[model samples]
Target: MAWYHSYFKGLPQVAWKLHQDEEYTDFEVDFLRDVLELKKGNQVLDILSGYGRHALPLAEAGCKMTCIDISAEYCDELSNAKTKRKLPVEVLCGDVLETDFGQGKFDAAYCLGNSLSFFPRADMLRFFTKIAGSVKPGGHVALHTENLAESILPNFQARNWMPVGDDIYYLAENEYRPEEGCIEAQQTFISGSEKVTHTVYQYIYTLAEISAMLESVGLKVVGTFGNLEADPFVLGDEQLYLVAVRK
Candidate 1:
């Protein structure tokens, strides 16, 4: 099984919850709304939508949301939240690569939270093609990642440690392989008496490569930003947020 198949369970999930900031989510959602020109009742797809952070809010705002996630734990949480809030959210648990996203079904689609790095070159192309075919003509697609080659290379760190919450401590040891154009990370999560370690892999793509791949899938690049505020992207900006339109 892939490392990502089991990476989101246990302490990692707790760490993610603790690390998330509501204010940041608000900023990101607003950016997405503007970039996608989303309106009430528009159908939206949230790729790898972990726990529906963006989906729930968009659904509450009157947009129809379809969220696909690989983790059943996250899908359950999202489903419970949808039930409690009575939101227009449909949560599907499965590998996004294999999931059938019908053609021309959605008005807009987004993959955020740095999830684009999960796939290698071929899989990335496949995912982009799926997304392009899933959205209507003139529809928009948005993506976010911090693993771009220009962003990570200049400031790469071999190891780092940080605290996620009062109880959870996290450490990451990263190894960059130029040949593979990927980062292999061994992450350790600790919370009180419990501890776990997992190996994570993220592919590194340059901006040119990513834009070309999106274009190859009939998604034309429109905007590239460094943050939710819509600043123009530059090298070593720590994040890449892209907006594309389906041709």
Candidate 2:
């Protein structure tokens, strides 16, 4: 299996452990709703939905959600959450690159948390194309990730450690390979004397490159932001948040 496949296969537990802040979750969900213009009963497709952080909130907000993840474990967890909460969510376990989203089946779709740039350029383009095929004409697409600007910055910190709670912390190490148009990271999670590590191979996409790919897939750029707060994307911004409309 590829590094990402192996890494994410069992990542639901660790990822959930680190991202349990309800306040931030609410804020992000609100941001997504605004970015996608989510309406009650609107059909939404969430690619790489993981344990359904965003999908659950969207579902609760009245959108019909189809959440997909590469990890069966995560998808099962999402399925349980849907049942427990009685939310309108469909959970599927499959590779996003290979999954079929029926033509014009959704009103909007999104791939957030740096999920868009995981594959090589060609594959990434195909992914966008597939996403376009799933959404109706003029539907929305939102993408959130750290942009190439920060990755190529001179003062970029390649390694960092952060505590999620009293007994849990994560160490992340990044290696930028511009020639290969990717950044590699090894993430180590330490929780109560137990340590788990995962490797991520992310292909870096510049704003222009990503824009072109979306356009090629018939998704036109509509808005750009630096964060969930909706600040305009500019140099030195912490990350990239783009909103596009299917054309």
Candidate 3:
């Protein structure tokens, strides 16, 4: 595995430390249900459901969820949470690229938290095709991610820091490669006197590029939002919340 591939594999505490905002989680889950039209007992697929942040809440909302993640620790956390809460949640530990849930298997599906960009650009189409094959005809799919346009902005900040907790901070530096259509980032976690840094790469796709890719895989673009509350998508928005339906 590459140095960045398993960067988040086993550290649930660290993951939570970086993304512990309950309001953000609730907003995402709300958008998933509202936009996807998911209801109680509906079958949903959550790709890269790290630590069940979204899956557990979706299960709580009465959805039968199948969550897949490469992180064994995250899957274990999900399994334990499901068992403890008696929620209809199935945790699958495997690579998203290799997993096959069969065609027309789900009513709704989602890949949130910028997970879609983790794969190389060469595999982008295959990834979307796989997702299209997993959902039933007319089923909805939602993807929340950082807008690629942001990377190309004239005033894009290459480095930034986010305070995580008392005496702890998360630092990030982004380097965009226009020729390769990807971003290589160096991320550092500083907690009191301890600090760790990791480098990772992610492909950046424009809204048009992503829409075309999804369409090529039989997923018709239905809606685009700038936020979780369903605001219309516009240029300069840092995030993109795209909703599509299987044809």
Top-scoring candidate (TM-score): 1
The regions of model 3 sitting more than 4 angstroms off are 2-4, 10-17, 150-154
Model 2 misplaced stretches (Cα beyond 4 Å): 9-12, 151-154
Q: Pull out the clashing pairs in model 3.
A: none
Mind giving the per-residue lDDT tens digits that candidate 3 earns over 55-159?
999999899999998877778878999999999998888887788776789999999877767777667888898999999998999998874665346456799
Residue-level lDDT of model 2, residues 104-137, one tens digit each, is 9999999876666678888888889999999999
lDDT of 1: 0.93
Query: Residue 46 in model 1: shift from native, Å?
Result: 0.5
Per-model TM-score versus the true fold: 0.98, 0.91, 0.92
Clashing pairs in 2: none
Whose TM-score is higher: candidate 1's or candidate 2's? 1
Over 5-88, each residue of candidate 1 has an lDDT whose tens digit, in order, gives 888888998898788899999988998889999999999999999999999999999999999999888999999999999999
lDDT to native, each model: 0.93, 0.82, 0.82
